[model samples]
Target chain A: MDVTLAREWMRAAAGAIAADADLLTRLDAAIGDGDHGVNLNRGFTAVVAALEKTPPETVADVLIKAGTTLMSRVGGASGPIYGSALRAAGKALPPAAEVQPADLVAALHAGLEAVRKLGGAAPGDKTMVDAYGPAADAFEQAVAGGADLAGAAGAAARAAAAGAEATVPLQARKGRASYLGERSIGHQDPGATSTALIFQALADVS
Target chain B: MKKFINDPADVVAQSLAGLAAAHPELRVDTEEQYIVRADAPRAGKVGLVSGGGSGHEPLHGGFVGPGMLDAAVPGEVFTSPVPDQILAATKAVDGGAGVVHVVKNYTGDVMNFQLAAELAADEGISVETVLVDDDVAVEDSTWTAGRRGTGATLLVEKIAGARAEEGGKLAEVAAIGREVNAASGSFAYALTSGTTPAAGRPGFELPADEIEAGVGIHGEPGRRREKLRPAKELVRSALDAILDAKTFTGPVLLLVNGLGGTPLIELYLIYGEASAYLEERGVAIARQLVGNYVTSLDMAGMSLTLCQATDEMIRLWDAPVRTPGLRWGA
Candidate 1:
């Protein structure tokens, strides 16, 4: 895959957020600041704009540029975390015009590690990591098992969705929900849902 | 429900137009959705970008002028702006020396800004991010999302932006922002939930005789709801919450702010109480800022932002600043 193809993935994610603004907003209302849809929409809209201005020649270039735009432009933790993820992923990628399934795994790993570093939190913390980490793992395992790129991406998306759903009962350790203490329990993790939405977008592109 | 808006969705966009029109010195991009300094893309200077949900008059947006923010992204009321607007702002502000993002610690706000920075980096614009988690109302144990980035965000924006404008590089600016967030704390008491124009009703209902402590700007419910106390008692409670935070033990810069609905007299009263309360604890006030710098929309409430000060902080606080709402040098 190239920059164009990856942005196609981003466009799909944008559509999901726009289509499910209510769902995303409701999820955020429960355990966040109630602006996931709006924020995501803003970030991805910037991504599209960047793409329109000058498309990246390499996959790494595309990912890094997209990540930076999100971090610089977006004004939330998600902006930095997701931005770092893509930048991390881009750094791990080879200077190739096209990407492979194995490349995708490396990208995911870099993205995950960047998030952990930036947020200073770990798994089971009721964050998007609940969804993103699992999908990254699942994608890596599938790719290592010799699964096709599209198939592994699809499996990753499914795993991510399931992981996001599983966050419903978790006590939040990140974001404003962390302020609610016990009140944060039983609410779905908005970050996880958005993470799942991201993987689902990847599947759409695949 | 009455607002001077053409449409709820277009409120931020149109208001940005008004911002540009009102101040020709600042470059407002209606298409890109940014309020950048007129001298923006300042060659080789580290750029500073700060934003949050709109409706907080003179906040992130109004604070964008010569000495503060290089650019400000305006989001919808109580909503984080989409990344595209942020990316545009970052690019517009980036003058080849990279950019720094000052993000409040709300989940959506943090996440979206991070994503924008990533996109910018891919385009070869180096980006660094610093999170502001200065609210003292939330418990600081490992189980929390950390602290809410409340009123102290104004302090960070002003100080960090000044440092960035003073030729501090991206890394240095980011470090100072983190340092500020570590040293600052805030707490808010809402006499009434904010009235959102789109929702028409209040964010939440507090009985006429009650107030909510630790209420955030976006209308999220606070830590506790209680019967309305006198201004002194309420200010004391707010001061205690902040003083009790892990990062608030040294000399401090105090920000006593009124929610949009509060009268100026009431704000002054709250400020007096806060000053006395802080002085009682031997917390020397290095600098004092009193006004409606950050606000919830039409909410009858106030917040106390206390930044534990270092000499560097005091110097930055006194730096020249110019904006539509705040001007020290003009």
Candidate 2:
């Protein structure tokens, strides 16, 4: 995948988040401040607008711009987490016009690491890290197994979706939902769900 | 749904515009959604800045004045303000003495303010932060992501603002803020949930015969829902919880804060009940304030805050303050 595909992935992710905005918010309302969907939607919409207004020529440039836009537009813990994720991923990539499937794997790993570091949440914390962490691992494994870029993306998406669904039984250990203690167990994490949606978008666009 | 708003999205901006029009003493930056004292950047004095989401009226914004916050950064309802806005406000209000950030201990607010502090330090501005976590409700809550900062935020802001106004150093003001927070405890109960403009619905629906006890300002689930009782019973329960958390023996400042939508008459009634309960417990209520100060958005409820007042705190609390929501001997 190249810079153009990266843009398409972002666009597809934006569309997916927009389509499921209310659902995400409803999930948040169950155990959060009830604005996750609104915040993410606003940030991604601004990112889309920014991308259209000043289209980046390189993969690194596209991702760096997207990260900064998310940092500014999305207010809350998720903003910094996702912003750092994208920025770390972008920084991991060399300034090249195109990126290989292996580069994508490295970028996902960096992004997941950034998210975990910034959010102070690990895989079982019932945060976006839960989904994105597994997705990164799955993508790297698929790439190592010599799967093509699209095949690896599909694998990552499936892993992320399953990871998100798997959050239902785990008690929240981080973020606002953690405040609920055991009560937060039944609800799927909104951030994890959104993460799954983002990977699904990447697969669809690929 | 019947709110007198042009659009849900515009509620905060429009309300800020109205505040600007009504109070010339305060300067409102509509674009950034921050309010600063007209005479800000008071040289040789510690600058105080505090803010949170917009729905809580007379809180960070309403408390901005001579004896309180120098600037207030407001975000969307129930959301923490972003780093840029906070960084801007910190810079705008900074004097040579440095700035004190009065932050509630919610995850978003803490993270964003910490980010701003880092940015400010890079620019050579010394910053001190005081995190308020005084609510005796749940140890953690949906909005807080930790022990929720409830009514004591106002008390801390006011006391710290007074210290800042008195030419206290950044460390001194921040220390006083922390002292206030540590010395205070709060509890709230809601008859109904607050309605966010965007949601167009109440945060939660409590039955008319039931009350949400030990609730936070943002309508997070409290200890439990129980059958509604008389004002005295509710006040007793709230006071008992607060006393259990932090036992106060001497003179204490009592704040009966009306979460918006509660009538002044009811607040007075609640205050009377709360004060009477304190009297029965042999705790002296030294200073008191009753009104819609720190509030949830149109949530029918009230919170009780008790701060163990020092002689210095009382003197500072009595100091002049001029703002839209609070005013005295100006």
Candidate 3:
């Protein structure tokens, strides 16, 4: 993947977040704060604007800039979580302008690690980590099976959607939804849904 | 939905503008979205700064004045303030005696404040953080990553702010704030959900006769939904929750807080019920405060916070305080 593909992924993610913002908020209302969609929308919108103003030259540069923009622009729990993911992913890009499939796998692994670190959430916590974790594993599996970056991205997207769907039966063990205990079990986790969107956006762009 | 707002997107910014217009003693930084006492950075005095979402009106903002917060940062409605705004507030208020951040225990607020503290320290300023997590509704909730900091926030601010104003060291003031939090407990019930401006709707829908008991300041679901009971019953239930958490002996501070939409008359009725219950139980209500101190935006509810007060706490509570929402002695 090149810088152009990386930038396209971000743009697509922003568009996707904007399109499904209300759905995300409604999901959050059932379990967490009703601002996930709005907050993520605001952050991604800022990311797009920042990219438009000063487009980066490398995949690592684009990811770092996008991460920084999200952290400063989004003032919610999602901000730092997503921001840390992108920044950590950017750091894994191996000092190259173009990202190979192996590089992409490493990037996803780093991103997942960052989310887990920042949120203190494990896979069964019904957080964004649930979707991101599965997506990263799928991406790594696809690359190991000799797939291209686009093929890996498609696999990640499908895995993320499945992971998001899997959250419906979970009792939240972390974040704000943990307060609801058993009540949070029936609702799909909003962060997981949004993470699926991010992976899907990557597939669409890649 | 019938709110006095120009645009949902501009709610926080415009509200800060309105606050700046209404209170000259408080300085509002529209660009940074922080409020500071006009004469802040008092030499040799420890600075007190606290903040959270915009909907919790009198809370961080209204408390920014003499004998209270030196600065308060407001985020978007029901959202935690960004680190930049918090950093600015800390820098603006820091005197030679250092700064103490009174942070609520919500995940976003705690993380943002922690980031700001690291940044502030990098800029050569000393910072201390005191987490207020006194809500007894649940051990953890959706609005909180841990037990929430609720009505007791007001008590911590007033008591700690006074100690800071008296030239106490940052550690000393923070210790007092922690002690106050340790002795305090809160329980709230929501009659209506807080309406999000962007959505123009409440997160939860309740029938006329029902309410969410043990609700958080945000629109998070409470312990259980039940039929709206009489004031005496509700007050007694709230007090029982607190008493179950920690028994208060001797003098105590009772704050009957309105969650924005409740009227003063109704608050007093709740207060009367609570006061009578505590008195009958032989718990002295030494310091009483009633009104919208910590609130969820237009949520028709009330929270009761009781702090077991020591003589020092009572003296600090009665100290001179001048702010937009609270004033005494001075």
Candidate 4:
């Protein structure tokens, strides 16, 4: 919820996508085409590049610019979904003010909604929504349970990781993997795993 | 691996640049994401546009020449080009008569292209579309995600382009597109994994001794994986899968497409196997195409497409076509 902490999460998200490219690619090979890791890496790399080129004046501006950069550069469903998420999160924020726990919850809720809308996918779709939805809920619930910003992000990251791991048992209902039917089972969703990493990276950042 | 690319991110962009440089006969809008013939629309002829993902070279790009497609849109590797890109290409190729879209029936491709059609209509462009779902890999896959739409795309583009260039209306061109969709079926097998530039690795893991049957063009493995079989048996299996339902079908157009990485000799070997099987079944191969009309990155495999053509269909198939990937017209 802290503005400093939330911005750090974005940076860490970029770093996380970069760091685990091979693992993500391996995950993708099992289910979808083995390009998610690299596709997202390139996209987030562009986001980092844009951020470096023009440091935003406000926290919200930072999120919006990063989101737009990813959308413009990322090629697949991940592009629009992640892009809209960041943009929505950015819009939910006050112009140049610090963010509180409630503010962070509100922003992430908007981001999750944007991702759901753009992807036309929902929970149990064996998509990033699986990780993101549970993560957001866990974060809010943890905060309600009297956790602080980092504490909430940590809970969110754990929930996201568990949700991503759980996708191995469920059949995919979205993306190219869905066409594989029962074969899509037993393979961890590359998108959901990468999403879990985003939250994990946020926890690491804190 | 032998490809001349700096990074996966720059492969498509760099390839587009090289394509533009090599072919001055086409006007390339890299930013808008289209390749249009230099003299497009040709005053009264209906426009033809077809595109899908990249990696399948000489497809949309190489096919953008006279007597073929008026415009070709290129998407990122294995991903369908978005609506804005297709719309931009559509407007650029419209000949005042009308425009016909030849779309492969992947859910994403269909959705995006249809959205583009709607966008074009809002801009006052009359666009007719044909959805090709010719791959017999799965039935009602994903509750009518439809067939995978592989292999037969080449036939559709060529035949429909000829009909359009010969003053056929948009509806007629679209009709030919639908006819191919109805009459054609394709089945592919993969002996090796394909490499996507960004991943810097094969798209899937196949055991050294395994072959994947019913694999799609996008390296999505296949319906079943079994021990690798002999070239002849492979062809027999592929043919049986395609021709099992047809009962002495009418005139058929045959295409033996190599799935990249497969040499001409192997393709011919598979063709020999497929041709002999057709001969035994008393199915006349009215027109036969061999070699790679479609490919899956670097996957070592081949798909066979059979289009049971009527007299009208045969006429369209024999029509002249001039494109980098397929050129018969002078």
Every candidate's fraction of true contacts kept comes to 0.45, 0.32, 0.45, 0.22
Enumerate the candidates' DockQ scores in order: 0.26, 0.47, 0.56, 0.29
The regions of model 1 sitting more than 4 angstroms off are A1-15, A41-75, A79-121, A136-158, A197-206, B1-3, B39-53, B65-133, B139-145, B156-183, B195-210, B246-253, B276-288, B307-322, B328-330
Docking class of 4: acceptable
**Tens digits of per-residue lDDT for model 3 on B1-330?**
899889999999888888999998788899988999999888888999999877898898999999999999988888888889999999999887899999998878887888889999999999999999999987744433678899999999999999998889989999999999999999999999888897677879999999999888888788789999998999999999999888798599999999998999999999889989999989998999999989998999999999999999999999999999899889
- Clash numbers, per candidate: 56, 0, 2, 0
**Which structure is stronger by TM-score: 2 or 4?**
2
Candidate maximizing DockQ: 3
Query: Which lDDT value does model 1 have at A16?
Result: 82
lDDT of 3 at A86: 96
Q: What are the per-residue Cα lDDT tens digits for candidate 2 across B46-97?
A: 9999988778988878888898889999988888888899999998898879
List model 1 lDDT by residue over B150-268, tens digit each. Answer: 88788888888889878998888888888888888888988887766545556567788988888778766688779998899888878887776655655888888888888889988
Residue B67 lDDT, candidate 4, scale 0-100: 67
Model 4 clashing residue pairs (backbone): none
B112 Cα displacement, candidate 3 (Å): 0.9
Q: What TM-scores do the predictions have?
A: 0.73, 0.96, 0.98, 0.87
- Residue-by-residue lDDT tens digits, candidate 3, A1-206: 98889999999999999999999999998877698999999999999999999998889989999998988888877877888899999988976678799998888899899888777888888898889989999999999999998899999999999999999999888877877767888899999999999999999987
Query: Which prediction has the highest TM-score against the true structure?
Result: 3
Give the CA lDDT, 0 to 100, for residue B287 in model 4: 89
Model 2 misplaced stretches (Cα beyond 4 Å): B140-144
